[model samples]
Target: MPTLSQQLLAKEAKYGASNYKPLDVMLCRGEGVWVWDLDGKRYLDCLSAYSAVNQGHCHPRILAALTEQASRLTLTSRAFHNDQLGLFYEELCTLTRSTRALPMNSGAEAVETALKVARKWAYQVKGVPADQAEIIVCDGNFHGRTLSVVSFSTDEPSRHGFGPFTSGFRIIPYGDADALEAAITRNTAAFLVEPIQGEAGVIIPPAGYLARARALCTEHDVLLILDEIQTGLGRTGALLAEEHEGIEADLTLIGKALSGGFYPVSAVLSHDAAMGVLKPGEHGSTFGGNPLACAVSRMALKVLVEEGMIENSARMGRRLQDGLAAIQTGVVREVRGRGLMIAIELDPAAGGARRFCEHLRDQGILCKETHTNTLRVTPPLVIDTDTVDWALDRFSRVLSAA
Candidate 1:
């Protein structure tokens, strides 16, 4: 006879696509920063569904909003206006400080939306030749997994077997302003980048890299699109990671945490010029701005501000980083991150990160390994100092053993 966890894993393997290599534990419920396994074991959720639960899992306010809106009305699509869509737009724009907002169901859809808008803006506003406009992208970006999104990916694993892909995208090394400058041309319509590369081992860009990139975009009349799907809504201490660099993107992509992990909500926030090219019937989604998503996102944003989660992230992040740095472990090669999106890079000679992650998991701290050698530790923004310290103690023990 198999244990419940074993049975579930086997069932998933037999029935589902083999796209993910998840841990052995099977989570049944989550609240705030902790999740319970089927066996009723409690573990600190360090990954937060790749920062989607920054407001913490099953946030009461967001859950209430979801339930309330769902009971009243759910999907109206884009054909007819829903009462919640306009308020959603207003609140999202005001929060992100953008002039226009295009709602979508996932981060990939928002990325696709931005690409289309940028290309159209290039042809119509920048006088670029039709079908010739190019968009610059960073090398280690993980925007999304769509065919078009994967078209520009530099990761061989992501790009393999996905082509022949869409054209009009150029790649450059991340955090290199000079490389970016060299890559640009009159046909360049936008520079699509992650403010901090999240999936590529939580890589932080060089200081002033964003400022320089912003300046270059302005000089060349190219739109700057910041993909903040993983780093936005207070995951990186600030409301948006772009605020750290004191720069604003011409277009910003947000999702994951937008509905506080209660729903799949994403949006492309644009300045007046970038989004102005899209007329009605040009681009839309069936459930992009559905009433339920709008209502849930509204509550998510409100609670994030009212609960002081952003400030908590900053303070807790500093504590986490300091603790990681002070760990007396020779296996640790480096510790880096912004806010709660931290990473521990192990020495190549010390073996891969998976074993360390497994050890931590056994000790009840649930984080994930990235890029084989780095452990990404992104807790919920609502996590407290004591929980962080508890997690750190487990991390210290695991790293020491490794």
Candidate 2:
């Protein structure tokens, strides 16, 4: 007889859309840094649901807050006030050091909100002519897959057949400050970018690139929108990746880990001047900032900060990166990342990264590949010294064997 996982896999293939090409492991449960398959095999969780579960899966505190608030109240929309919303706003703003916030339900929605804010600010505040505003983006950025976001994308897969696309976006090479300056025009509204291109094989830009970009944005009066959905909330060892260069963005986007992987909660954290463009009825979401989301996100931030997950990320990230680099193997082309957002790039001659990932799965570890040749290792922030060392041993074994 076919196993339960096989049965479920067949069922999904028959019924579900083929949007994602996930690994052939059907997971049943997760806690802390580990997950179990339907066949009762266990493995470390290295992806963290693209950093949404940075606080780890099924955290007790976040779970408690979720259930308690779920029992009391769930949604009231923007028309009514909830008891948890104000507190959530205060805490998040204080932690992120943002003056204002526009709550949403996903990283994509937050990106959309920032785009709208930037365009509105351009016309209303910067004296740009109507419908002439343009936003500059990096070449290999993966902000989100929404139609408007994909319009600026240079990746063919994300853009093919998704258009006739949105307009008013200009493409510039990633990490090129000179290109950014040359691309800016009188109607340029904002410069949207990722500090480290997470989806493009964990690609980090040249040092001082972000600081230069920040200064240019200020000098040109262009709002800097830093999308931290994949890199923020301790994924890169910093509270926000912008802190790495000691720079601030006019609009900051964060999501994924905001609700500890328990709920779909995201927000646009904004500078006071840029956010002032939005009025009472200009924009909104039905489930954004609802009581349940607020409650879960509040606890998520608390445990992440109070429990020292950020510090752990910094220390553990260094240890893991060093260990991966120490592994002597002809297959490894490079090992690079900030914090726990690691990537092991394989030599093209050594086949693709997918086989290494499959080998990892069999060895009781779980990680995924990006851009064909790079495997990303982004375990939950709650991972410890022992776990990092343990994962390193298996990773070394797999790469060395190849």
**Which candidate should be chosen as best, given lDDT against the real structure?**
2
Tens-place lDDT per residue, model 2, 306-397, is 99999999999999999999999999989999999999899998889899999999999989999999999999999999999999999989
Clashing pairs in 1: none
Question: Which regions of candidate 1 are displaced past 4 Å?
Answer: none
The lDDT for every candidate, in the order shown, is: 0.94, 0.95
TM-scores of the models, in the order given: 0.99, 0.99
TM-score of 1: 0.99
RMSD in angstroms, all models?
0.8, 0.7
Error of 2 at 302 (Å): 0.3
What would you estimate as the lDDT of candidate 2? 0.95
Q: Which pairs of residues have clashing backbones in candidate 2?
A: none
